[model samples]
Every structure is written in structure tokens, then in C-alpha cells.
Target chain A: MLDLSRVQKELVDCNRDKSSGVSIDLVGDQLSHLAGTISGPIGTPYEGGVFRIDIRLPDGYPFEPPKMQFVTKVWHPNISSQNGAICLDILKDQWSPALTLKTALLSLQALLSAPEPDDPQDAVVAQQYLRDYPTFLGTARYWTEAFARRVSIGTEEKVQKLVEMGFPEALVRTTLENAGGDENMALEKLCSG
Target chain B: MGWIKVITKESLLVAQREDLRNIMDLLEVSEKHARTLLIHHRWDADSLLAVFLEKERDRLFSEAGVTIAEPNVLAPLQSSQVTCNICNEDVSADAVTTMDCGHGFCNNCWTEHFIVKINDGQSRRIRCMFYKCNTICDEAIVRNLVSAKHPDLAERFDRFLLESYIEDNHKVKWCPSVPHCGNAIRVDGDGYCEVECSCGLQFCFSCSAEAHSPCSCLMWELWVKKCRDESETVNWITVNTKPCPRCLKPVEKNGGCNHVRCICGQDFCWLCGCAADQHHARSSCGSYKEEREKKTGQAKRDLFRYMHYYNRYKAHTDSLKLESKLKKAIQDMETISDSKEFSIKDFSWLTNGLYRLFRSRRVLSYSYPFAFYMFGDDLFKDEMTPEERELKQHLFEDLQQQLGANVEKLSHFIEESFDEFLQVDRIMGIRMQVINLSALIDNLCKKMYEFIENDLLGRLERVTHNIAPYESKGVERASELSDSWDSDDSLSMKTCNVDSYLQWDSSANGAGSSESGSPTDDSFDQSSSLDESGCSSRKRAKKEALDDPPFNLNLPAEGFDKN
Candidate 1:
């Protein structure tokens, strides 16, 4: 009845693409609410480990940006660790009807890789973020492994990674999403776009 | 696609050099259009638009909407009242908007709130007017609500509202302000403090000054309006301008020209309100003698009317200074007499009353010469080091300025820090004989009741810094390093990072240097409104001192403190 499917498809697509290596894991079902995994983007502290992400789409479809929360603990300027609520303009005050869930995930992946240190949602993280971007990356990657790597059977590893090199599963999922969900496509997307 | 002589697409593509560059400037053209154009015509970024222009005759001009010829399109109505969400301004009915929640507000106010994210081009997520539900509005309601009311502004501001456009943080981008420069700057929106144009132009968003334009939205509106009006006038006059009748050279006049007579024996007529032809109108009806007499008579009556407001502004400035002096003296007395000392309290009250009385007089003082002094309240508490309090006295002055200068130099400095701040303070101190020269100026201004408090004490405040020990004063030494952050999550909140925020690392005019200085440092002293007051309170304290002083004490009446 609603355009939820279209918006979800876009989220699925965006989750697969991005400069930040992205990975998505469907813990439960894909049509309703879903949990995804992403590896740490390269050069970021979240490089090695896996990170979990949750996407909750409303019935209104593309008109509303989906509510996404980081299931894994990772340091970021906009994301609050207390609940992993993000402070990106596109997701909150700037939610556009034109945006789909896929775009939101890709944006989140981008936010993870290159965070803003000026208008920080997290004051502490922002301080460290402005003072040292590299160090923030270190802890972010470390946390990704500590939390996101937990996977069992029947769980589809739909994660995407975009940025190559040191970027782990988080980027892998992002890459996968950007590449239209094909591993080779992911590599090609990374090399090209 | 070329409308000219028949030319193959291959030949045209080979001839053009910038086919690829033009796509970047197409603000309205979709990215898909660029891809299609590139594929079909093989046009590069520079010439894709050219190819489009070859098809859509008025393409680029139509996109930018450069046509605003009708100035009288809307007649100026009288006393129109439209409720605004922020204020009850009287705007036109067409400017009013009623939200779905039944809130009525003018478009101007909504736009002001909506422009919270300037770079992202997103409208501010305004809170509901209803007191009960203070929820931040989503774009859906704003679109539906504003459209039903003022469809024009809603449409105009809608593009500015990015709430849903760019989901998930794509990199922050900016409108390239340079000529022919269209690359969106992938900048961090957190600091959003500075914008470095691709042309290597740097500007501050805080002052609206070059390199860093930082005025608020209203000031920006005024400045932009002025620039636009000027540019429009320039462009219009340049296009259809009449020549200086005699010289036959095109002329553009900024000022009112009632008698724009040519060098030739021709008189221009102001009464007609239009340009005159070869046969010009006669001047003054040959009654120049009578008109001169009449104007001479009017001058006398207008002088008093003119002085009335001027005098009022003068009185207002004087009272402001007296209040500042009294307030400062009282604050110092109170701090020293924390245990409630009688002499300190008595002095504070005495100065307060004297300051108030002077404030009430609101008269022009022509006879009394003024003076200022910031000597250590050496007479006050013995336990607290006079040096610290006295140097801290300079702190009160420096708190107001980021890069302090002489008391006279005070008039010159407004926000721009020296090459270095601390050393400048020390170097500037050496120039002055006083230990706390900056404070000495403030004290001197207070003691002498000098006029131009902004010029004097205001400049001394530049070198002042809000300092806290890197490590806590207590045993924990816990940096709470996180405490300095604006939020636990934003990660981009850039406040409290002193090293990154406060620069001017160069030797501040040899400030700290023991040699080559003046006597202003003798009175150097300091306050920090509670740590919670923020840098703004300091700015306010300085501005308020000028606006709300208790007396018109113009010290150094005859250039005594002149730099």
C-alpha cells in the first residue's frame, strides 16, 4: 500500500555503497525491522572489528527518513553512545521525503568515516574529534570488533565495505551496498565511484 | 543540438574545451541530466550546459531567475498586521502562514528560524508554537502548513529546508562564493566557523568581515540587501544610463541629484523626476536670492531639533560609563569583602549612589576634566596577593578584547587578535610602566570618568583569556576531558578546545617581553562570570559598559590618552 518497499530498497542499495567500508547483517527479517553489520572504515579506529546497525522504517515510506541506531559502540561526532542516536542533518531536522532508507545507511557509513568535530552531538567525542581525528578512528575500529563481529548461521552477511585497505567489515558492508550487493560489484564500485 | 550552421556533434565536441566544467555550475540541472548529456552529446562538464543552451534558448538565464523588473508589483500597504511565531510583526497577509496545528506566524520569522542550517540549505526545525507540545517540527507539517498560507515564501524557503534532502551525513558542502567557482566545499559543518573558498579565499562566518564573516542572520540580511540593491542599481544604470549631457559620457550617481546640470549651459529639472532632454528646464524661477534667504532661516530651526537627539545619545552614553565604573568598583569591593567588611561595603555603596546620581543628571559636562586609575586595591585584602588581583584587574579589560592594545589603542582593536596574544600582552606591558597596564587603563578610565569607554577599556580586554588549569585544581586532576566538549555525542561541538580555538600564537607585540613596553600594565588586573556564562557574557559585559555607563566622564579631554 505504501512506498516502504522502494525506500527499503534504496537503504539496501546505499548500505552496499560508500567510501567508508559498510557491512549489513539481517539479524531477523528484512521486510520489517532489521539489524545489519558494518566493518570499520579504513584509517578509522573502527577498522578491524564488525559493527551492528539497526534500521527501523515507518509505513510513511520515503517521505520519512528511517530511524537508524548503531547497535555497536563506536565513537562519532553525531552519534550518542548512550543510545546511538545520530545527530546528522539529513536524518533529523533535515529529513527529506526524497531520501530513502538506503541513502540514510550510506550517509551513516560516511558519518562514521569522516565525522564533524564542530557541532558535535557528543561533547566529549567532539573534543577528541577536533583534537585528534586519527585517535578517534582507532577506538571506533576497536569497538567495532568488540561488538559487531558476533554472527551465527542462517544470518545473512549482507554487510558492505566501501573504503578498502585497513577498513574492515563496516566498510565491507558499505562497499557491498554501494555495489548493488554483488561482491565483485562492490570492488568495482570502490575502484570507480 | 547546435542551432547555428550544421555541425556534427563529434566536430562540436572536439572544438569545445570546457564541456565537462559547465555541468558543475548547473545548480538546477539534475546529475542525471549531466550523465545523459555526456553520453548523448559527449559534452564535458564545461560544455554540457552550452549544448543545453543550444537547445533551450533562455536556459541558463531562466534557471537563475534574474528577472525582477517590476518594483511596484506589490503596492506598499499601510499598517498590515500578520502574527509571526517569534514576534508579532505586522507583515502582509500573503506573508502569514498557518501551520496544521493552527499556529499563525509571518514568513519572515519562520524563515529566520528555518535558516538554522545555512550550509546544508535546510530550514530550521522550529519548535511548535503550542506550549504543550514543544516538539521540533518535521518538514511534512511545515510544507503542508506553509503552503496553505503563504505559498510563495514556503516555496522560496523550501529549497533552503534540507531536513529530508540529504539523509545520513553526506559530506558538508557550501555555495562557492567566488566568481565562476562552483565546487561544493566538502567541509566539516561542525566548526562551520570558517569557509575557505576554492579560490583560496578565507572568510569567518562570525563577523561578516572578510576572511571571517560572522554576523547573525538579520545583519546578513541587511548587508545582502544593501549589496543586492547596490549591484542592481549598478547593473541597471550601467546598462541604460544616460550620459553626462555635456560630456556625453555615461554617468552613475549614488547620491541624490536634484540639479544634475551638465557642464554645458543646461539646468536639470528635479521637479519632473525624470531625465531632461536637450532643451533643459530653467533654474530657481530666477528667485535664488529669495530661496537662499529662506534656507538660511530654516537652518536655525533645524539645528536645535538635530542637537536634541544628538544630546540625548550623548547623555545616554555618559550614564552608561558611570554605571560601569560604579558596578566595577562595587564588584571589586564585594569580592574583597566576601566576609562582609564594613569599609569595603561602604565604599561600594558610596560609589554606587554617586554613579546613580551622575547617571540621573544626564547632562553635558564641559568643565570637569576626567581621569582613570587601576592601581592594585593594595588597600584591600592583604591575604590575597595584590599582584594577582591587580593583574587580574587587567583580566576584566582583556576579557573584553581578544587582542588588547593601548587604552588609546583600545579604540583601534575590535576582535582581531595580534599575531600572538599572551606575548603581545607582555610586550605591550613592557611599553607601559604599570605592572598591569591593561588594568591600569581600565582603572584610569574609571578614575577619570573618561568618555569613549569602548575605545579605552574595550581594547585593553583583547589579550584577556578564560584560563583553567589543564589539570584540575583538586587531587583528582581528572581532565573530565569530556567536560570541555559541548556534547557527549555530537563529536563536532568545537567549544572548549582552547588550543584550536584561540590562536594568535605570535609574540603579541612583545607583550610578555620584559623590555620595550609602556606603563599601562601597572594596573593590569581580571573576572570570569561563572564558567557557565560563556564567551558571550564577556562580549556583553564589554558592550554593556559602553551602553549603560553611569557618567559622561570623558577623561583626557584634549588627547591625553590619544594613541
Candidate 2:
């Protein structure tokens, strides 16, 4: 079984530190499924982007590493472009029970900054990264702009959008703030509520 | 000679125990640590020793995930309680167990880690649960913790550890039997040799295919694939058919002139395989292209050359299949001769010749494929000049032809109705001929092997092809691995079922050309023995003749004189 108490503890502890720029929240009521978000490291092609990761804890959680895949698309040599499959060692054979969802998300942020072109999940991206550095940099920055950047829509607009979808305005504002300014999350919370 | 031993499931422990014991004794380590070291080295003791001697003790131990904990570093926690980072729980210190690496985790977390790794088929090297700590967890702990919750998985873990000897070792290979026999064969030395398993499946140890010696594993592999593929049939099609210009389908001319109509209703000239209406007469179609003819000529010659060898190989193979039925006929003859009042009541020569025929027929068939690759431009084109290839081919083929002719003669004599012979001298004459021929075939087969190994393949410059040396007896049947048999004893031992006479025959005639005289001379000596002992001699000779054994020959040792 998933260590529900531990996962719950991890969520609370991770959310307590907002400065870490990595947070985990329950995707549904089940502790096994969660959504993690990591702000890209500064001075990298992926800077200013908040990448969402989908985390699913196997039954052997704490013993087995949680399966993490990209939810917000980002261009890098080690993350698949066609499917948001991240090829990180910590997610595979190198995984240890000592790691948690927060550390895994931080590792993803590190992977974004330092893309391993030699051991790549995306061959085309890796080839460009090795052969033409400028093109790889431009493509990664463009992908961050196109896909990973957080919506800059004002809190009032998100609240208005939710309220227009038959939700109370006060609840919409709080939900948008809780979702970290993610309009889609605010809409989902409003509809579910 | 190299020996083979069958490692059945029951004897697998014994098979691996020797290697484990060696590493354990030499390294002064426990069995678990020894196993970890062996497994890390893929059960290669020599290479492990080389590494042990060359590298630092700490490095060797650390590389294999064997953590020899520093005593000072393994101090127990002062407080009775601690927080286990894995589950983020505060548990009593008694609930936690510290590994040799000095990293402690709660029992629950450790068990979960072992279960996950075991299920993932990584039970062979279940490292510590602590991150970045490469220490391998103790097997005893794993077994203890796992068996508490899941007993079957613990058993699977033990089996995986035991089977790693065969799975990881280079010298041992699983018998490639269909619906797998659950047995592996371990050769003592020379992986190039062929061996017959206890289950009676003979295979080339190097390639694990059916035993095809006199031909290297590479040649036999290519020969088998070539026979299986439709390349020859395609060659036949190319030789006999022309494609229609419209549909690009190969069209065989049933019976027609050069200008024929295809079934697709397209009229084409067969010479150049081009469309021919009314006005398209013999413009360029009649003129032959030099390049096309050369290519086609080469293909035609290759097809014919392959046919020459393939036909002989197939013929001998088919004869072997048919002659296997002769065993029952020979048995009936044995029964008839037993009831007869003839002077030549001992028909041991008949069965001996029959065994020789079977052995030689196999050698004869596989030699064709050997010659095909040896002389042909496919494998060894650069290995030899054309003149040298022809000379070596003649030398090898002469031996092959002599062996083939003698095998046919032996087969013919064994097939004859000797049981119906009324004349005593006629039966005796046939007996002498059969005995002589058997020995001659055996010697010729030995010579052919020597020639292939020493003269032909040994002289190659760049590449080496090792064929299994010929056994005068037959393909050596692998002995069962028993507790009583040690490595030293197994080295000198022949097949467990072989009689002392065979031991004498094989060992006594090792490499003395003077002692290994003509086959007729050996037969004459055996006939003299037959003349002296009479009834007892027949039983002794029959025992020597029969392939399967455990018959007591009860004669004086000096009286036994045979090849």
C-alpha cells in the first residue's frame, strides 16, 4: 500500500516552504496521485517557466520511486518532445527511498538547467544540442515560451472567468490563489465544488 | 580430452558450491559476501583473483557492494527513538536495523525495499535502502524479512542466486532442448568442443546447435540458414523464369517460343524480358550484354557448386536416417545367430561395424559442408590461394572418400543376411571384413580430423576455426554430476556408462603411430582371442561391440587385444 501518512506529511512539509519554488498538491482525493510544479532555474533557457509534473506513487512507495512525467511541455535533451517522458536516473534504477516528491521535482529543475545531451531521451533534440548549440538554445527558449510559461492573466480575470462559469466570485479568487495562479486549476476546482 | 557434466536442478547447488567455496576460502569471507563477489565477477574466479590481487581491499569490497563496516562508525544511537526518513515516521530504535554500512532503516521500510527489488528481478544485488549508499543488503536479512511475509518469493530469490552460476558463468550453458530439459552442461575445458547431454541431445557447445563438427560453428550456421532460406529456389527461379514487363511478375514459360504471352495478357520477348508488340522485332533483344551474362554465369556456377556439396550432404544424412532403422534388423539377426549352430556364432563384428557406419556417415555428411566453406570463396577466400585450396581439397576429400567408401562397405556387410548363411567359412570371412572395415573407418575419421585441425585450419593466417576433435567411440555422452565426483576425478573419467575396454581403446592408443598399426592387424589379434576363449569370448566381444554398457568382460587382461 502507499504510505498515505507519509505522502500527506510530505505535501504539508513541501508546501510549508514556498521559497523552494517546488510544491506538491494532491491531484485527487487519493494520496497516490499528485501534481508537482517547479519553477525553472534562472539564467537557463527555461527560466520564467513553471513546469508541472504528474506524479503517481506505486504501491511500493518510499521503497519504489514515484513515477514522474512532464505535464507542462519543456524542450530539453533528456525529456521526450513527442511524449512528456523524462529520462532521469533518480526516477529509475538509481532511485532510493530517501528521495521524495519535492526532491524529484527539484531534480527536474536541475535537469532543465543541465540537459544531458550524451544520455538523451530525445535523439533529435540531443543531436541539435550537440551539433548546433544556438539552434538548441533557441528551440528550448521558444518551447518554454510556447508551453511552459505560466499564464500571466490577472487574478481578477481568473476569478471572473470562474464566476462566469457559475462559481461564486469569492471562492474563485481563493481557488485561483491556491492553484498558484493556474487558471485551469481554478476552473477545475470551481466546477468540482 | 575435455569432459562434460550435466548440472540438473538437484545438482546445481553442488555445481556452484565449488566456485563459492574457492572464493570464500581465498578471500576469508562469508558465503553471502563470496556469492556477491562471484556474481559481480560473473562467477569467474580467476578474473576475480586478478582484480583482488591488483586492487586495494577496500576498493574491491566496495565495488561489489560488500560493506565491511568500520566498528567506530557503527555506534548505536544514544536515544531510544529515531525518525526514519523513508516513511517520515518516528519509530523506536528496536524497530530499526542498521546495515553494515552503518545506515539504519525501520524494518517495515527495509522489507518493502527488498520486496520491490526482488519483484523487479534485481534480487541478485539488492543494495541498501539509504540513498547513495551502494552497500548490498545482507541476503540473510532479505531472506529472513521476506520469508516472514512472502515465503514463495524468498524461495525464488534463493533459486535466482543458485542459478546465477549457470546463467552468469561462461563455461556452462543450458542444454538447448525444446520444452527445455531444465539441465545445463558444463564443459571442463575447450568451449569449441561438442557434447551430448544426459538427455541424449548432442550439440556444439560454442553455438548450441545440433552437433556439426568437421564444419566450424560459423560454417554450419551459414549452411543451416542457407538451407532454410529460399535463396536456392530464387536462384532456380532466376535461371528458369523471366518477369513480365508490365506486372514485374516472374513468368515461367510452360512450352513456347522466345516470344511468349504472359498470363497477364502482356506479350514479352523471353530473351531480354521486354515488351514486344508487332513492330518491336529483334532490334537489341538478340544482342547479349556481357555484364548480364557474367552475372548470370556466376550465379549459375554458384548454384551448381552448392548443389554438388548439398546433394552429397543430403544423401549421407538421409542414409543415416534410413540406417537407424537397421538397428532393429541387426537385433533380429543377433537373436537368429544366438539360436544357430554355426561356427561363427559371435556376430559382435556385425554390430561394431554398424556403429562405425553410423559414426562415419555423420562425419561424411558434415565434411561436405566443411569442404564447401573451406574451398569456396565465401569464408576463406583470402585465407588461401586457389592452388593451395585445390591441393588441400584433394587431401581432405581423399580421406573423406576413403572413409565414405569404407562406411558403405561396412553398412553393406551389416545389412547382409549373415544369419541365413549355411557355410561357416563365408560367415567367418564376412566377420573379418566387417571388423577390419570398422577399425579402418575409425582410423580414417581420426586422420581426417587431424588433417582438418593441423594441416588445413591450423595454417590459416588471420582467422581461426576450431572443430571438435573426433572421438573413435562416438560423441561423448556427458556424465551426471554426482557428489562423489570431484574436479580432478572428472578430468580423468570417461562417460559413466563406458566399459573398461573403451577406456583402454581410447587411452592406450593416444599418439603412438607405431602401436596404432593397420586396422587389419588389430582385427587379426581380436580374431585370435575369439579362437582361444570360444563361448566366453563371444560375450566379451559382444560387450565391446554394444554401444551401451555395464557388461562384465570376465577375461584375462592380456587376452584383450583390439583397436
Candidate 3:
């Protein structure tokens, strides 16, 4: 059995260090279960949306990358699975020695800008990505409003979401920043109790 | 006596003719006497040898005297061929002709003349007595001459020459002036005077007078005794013993020896040498042999007490003289502080001897002849704090500027002393003066540093400042100003020399010395003797230096002044 608590700490820092970020958490103190959140990168069609994600650390973490998945169903070719299983090179076999939580979050923000469909973990999202990119972005936004927007920021939110999770009260008051009005989705993190 | 003979041809001819003109021309001896000699030789100048035989024959007659033996066969009959010039007798073939003069004289006569001339202390310049030839005679003439022929005349001539030298110039001892004073003194050391006649005539050594003896042994003995008796005499008691009469070894009369003999075995006649001998004189005479049985018993009693006090007094006086000599030496010796060369130990010995001599000679028995009065008000000290010192700066400056500057006041001080001096107070004579001077010098030395360091320095600085800066402008002008000031100062510095001047000293001399020595005797150092030699007379101007100074305070903090 793997203790997933280490992934919760990294997921919390991912949100604090980068605004368009992703996070992970252990599920109910159970050994192999986790929870997380993901955000849309700003200035593109996905700017007004929220995304949910989940993660789990292996027993050998820091040597092993955390397992990440999309909790909110999305049509994004980069993010895969209804449970937020994401495939990124850093998380897989291609990870470098010097990568950290903040670098991982920044990498995620870059992936939103230029997603790699050919190596998509979701074949349906990848086909739609080749056929009509605008609709895939539209569906991805809808999924963020339908799933991640309904929740409050997690108590285990990353540093930025902890701030959104009421660590700093000012970030939570702006409805315009939360386009789907999903406080729970913005605040939810692997660090949630 | 024989002599060398010398003659001029003219003089010889005149003599042969019997002109006898030598005596007539003798006013100044204008003509020098020439010398001729006749010598006996191996050469046979037959005629000269014949004259020599004639002279010898004449000598035999004169020496033996003209005795006509009744059987006088050997006596030659009178023949007027030639007379021997020296013996006034007949000259036969034996008569010798004096070589240079060719005059014939008896051989014995010529020989004796030469010997007489040589014996005279003057070995040079003797000539023969030949009538015509006044020549220095040779050895042959000397051997031929005989003096016995005219012994009476020779004795007369010697006596005349001696009398003449004495009449001209030379010293001869003179009889003491007292008719038959039976003493003679040579006018050798310091001209002859009858005053110090050693034979006890009381005549002067320089001139014949009772008063001429400036000091006498008797007076010296009395003075010495009195000096030894002085209060300070106790400090120098050991020296009071009279020295040996011969060796001057101080003799202490120890044990039963009636006569004290020095280490050299010379008996010291103490009374004769010093007053101490009077003890022996009176003690020895105390037991005069009692004449009768009546006073015999009383005489013994008288003998016991006869000279007891006198003997004691005499002994005391002797010791006192030694003590005083020691004191005088200390007083008269060149000041140890005055000279750098003297060591304290050397000074002590000298002083001790002088102390002995002083008491032995009693020159200081009188009031000390000198005293000092210092007028410097600047004697207050800087080293000693205010509570310890008394002289203040203001008062000192006032005293110097006001009182000291006035010569009249100083004259009054001197006059006051003078008036007291005129009153012959014998008991407190120069003794008082010496005591006063000792205190004065000590006090002055003590006060001088205080004066110099505390007050004099500041005052002197002011005085130096008062001197105008003259090292500027032309060197000649600066020097000329100095010269003018120096001359003016010289005029300011003078004290009057004349007897009639009723003036006060009108100047402040930095360290003025009186030129006349004793204050009593024309200002010669009126100080009492510092010597065994008669009062070590010094002029008043001769100030003794206390120690060498230009004193660097680093040298044990003592101020020294150089002589």
C-alpha cells in the first residue's frame, strides 16, 4: 500500500506557485486514494472555466512522480479520463532530476497553451481535437462548469487555492474570477480534510 | 813665587836703564801687561843657562839670608856684574834670563812666583814681578822663583785684595743691633730685621724694634691656648696634644714617663714648644728642697698643692691650642665647596691639622674678624609649599626693589658694625666674626637655591626681558649699544675707594666683591684665619665658589657653584 500524503503537499504548493495549476490529495486517509483540482489557463477560450483533478504519490515519491487524473470530465486533448488521469512526460518516464512542484505546475500551464493530441491519453478528445479544436475547448469549458464549478475550494487547496480556499479572503469575493460560481471546485485540493 | 813674565820692548829698556816709569803711568793701567816666560829645557843656550846658574846662586843667598859665615869662603866677594832681579842679590853665571823678557832673576825667585800665582783661586791672569817685564812666567821661571825671599810683602798684598772686595759689594752677616746682642742674622730670606731674633731678644727680623714682631711665640702660645679653650674645642680634642718638639709628632703624655719622647726618641720640651710644656716646668719645681726642719713639715704640704691648678690649666691650654688649630684649619682651609678637586677625606685631615695648629697658635682666639650679611630678599623657596615657606614673592621684590636698592641702608648696616668694632671689646673679638661667617655662608647656600629657583628665576627672567633685544639691526650698532650699557653699568657698579667718602654703596652688584681685603684692615678678608699658616689672609674680592654650577637638576638635585 502507498501512502498518498506526500502528493497532497506537492498539490497544495502547485496551486500557490502557479495560478493555472493542478493539485492532488489522499482519499479519506486511505492508502491508495487521492483528490485534486486543475484550472484553465487564462487568455484562451478555457479562461472562464474551472477544472478538477486528482493525484496519488507512490511509496517511493520524489523518485516517482505523482499520478494525476482529471476529476472533471473535459474534452481537452492533454487532460485524460473522467477520474483525471493525466499523462505528461515529467510525470512519466521522461521526468528530469531537478523538476519540482512549481516546475510541474508551470509545465501544466504551458501544456494548456499547446496541447499534444498525438500522445493523447483520451482517444475521443484527441479525435475531436483533430476534427474541431473550438468545440473541444467548448466542451472542456462546459465540463468545468458542470463538475468543478459546483464545489467550494478544498480545505487541502494548494497555496493559491488555499488563498482562494479562504487563506486570503479577498480572492474569494470576486464572482467574475470564478466564472462558473464553483467556489468548491476552485478551493478543492488534495490537502482537503 | 815664580810667575810667567811678559814685557814690551820699550818697557824692558826703560826698566834696565832704571827709569822705573811703570808706577808713574799707573792711573788707569792704560797699557796692558805683557807676559814672558823662561823655561828649563834640554837645549843648551849657554848664555841663558849661565844666567840661570847665577839666578840659582842668588836664590840660595836670599833664602838662607845674607849671613856672612866667619869662615865664609863660599860667600862670593861682591862683584857688580849683574844683580838677580827677584832676590836683590848678586847674579852670577847661574842667574836665569826669564825667556820672553830676557831679564835675569834668581832661579828660586822666579819658580816661587809661578807657584804663588797658580795657588790663587784665580788660576788665570798672573804675571811675573820682573821690573821691566810684566809677563806670565813659564814653569821654569816658576820653579826658579822663591817666595820666602819676600814673605812679609806677599802676605801684605793678599790681605789688601780681600779687604777691597768686601768694600765693593757682597753680603756679610751683621751683629744684632743690641750692642753685644751677641746675635747675627743674615739678610737672606726676607731682609734682615731684628724683630724675630731667635735668641729671644725680641728684636725685629726686618728692622730692629720691639714692635716689629707681628706675631710672637709667646703670643701664639697664649692665643693657641685660648683657641683650644673655645667652646668648639671639644670637637677637636685629640689634636690638642702638643706635637713633638723635634718631629712634630703629636705626643700624648702616657703613664709614668716624666719626659715624653717621640717615636724618634727626641725628647719633647712641651713648654718650650707649646704652652703644654709649662705643665712640666711648674710640676717639676713644686718640691723645692725644704731648707729647715721648722718649715720642713709645712713644705711637704705646700709641695702637694703648690702648682696643682696651674698644671691642670696648662694641660687644658695645650689641648685647647690643638683644638683651636683644628678649628682654624677648617675655617681657613680652601673651601671644599669652593673647589672641585678637594676630597672630603683630604679636607678633613687638612682641617684637623689646621685645628691643631690653630689651638697650637691661637690666632682665632679673638672675635671672628669677618661676618656676612646677605641682602637678597629672594630667598623664599618654590619646592617647599606655602605652609613650610615664609618669604613671599611680593615682599621679596619689594625688599630688593626698595630696601636693597638703597645703598644708604647698607652703609648704615656696615657703619653699625664699624661703630661696634671701634669699641675694643676684647672678649668678643674676631671669634664672633668667624662664627657669624660660618652661619652666614651656610645660610646663604641654603637660601640661594630657594632664592634662585623660587624667586630669582622669575625675577631674572623679568630682568632679561628688560634687556632690550639687541640682536637686530646692524651688528655694530647692537654691539655698540651693549658696550655703552656695559660702560654705564661699570660706572654704576663702582664703590668708592677714598677714606673721606661718606657715601653709601650706590649700586646693586650681582655678586660684588670688595677690593680692599680685610674689612678691618682696608677690607682684606676680615675673616679669621682658615689656616695654620698665619691667618690665611685673602682679599675680600676672593669669593670661594660653593660648587660647580650651571647646575643641571639631574645631578642629584644639588646646586653647585664653581670657583
Top model number, DockQ: 2
| Candidate 1 local lDDT, B357-396, one digit each (tens) | 3322221121010101222221123423556545644654
Off by over 4 Å in 1: A11-36, A42-44, A56-65, A87-89, A92-99, A115-119, A126-138, A152-193, B1-563
| Candidate achieving higher DockQ, 1 or 2 | 2
**DockQ, per-model, please?**
0.01, 0.75, 0.00
Best by TM-score: 2
Task: Show where candidate 2 strays beyond 4 Å.
Answer: A155-193, B70-80, B231-304, B328-348, B377-398, B417-419, B454-456, B459-464, B484-563
lDDT of 1 at B491: 20
- The whole-model lDDT of each prediction reads 0.41, 0.80, 0.37
Model 2: chain B TM-score relative to the native chain B: 0.76
The per-candidate TM-score of the B chain, in the order shown, comes to 0.19, 0.76, 0.19
Model 1 collision count: 194
Question: What iRMS does model 2 reach?
Answer: 0.9
Arrange candidates, best TM-score first.
2, 1, 3
Candidate 3 C-alpha lDDT tens digits along B1-563: 00111112222232112111221132111111111111111111233236546676434222222122234443443454565533335666555443433444555445444444444432223443432233333322333242345545444434322222122112212234465433333232233222222233433333233321112323323434544564253323334565565554456776564456677777645444422342565654445464433323443343323233223334544644444444433434444334444222123223222222222122111111100001112222233355433454344334323322222232222223323234434313323333333223333333433443345333432232111111101011000011122453222122123221111111113122355443333222222222222332222212221111111112111222210
CAPRI-wise, candidate 3 is: incorrect
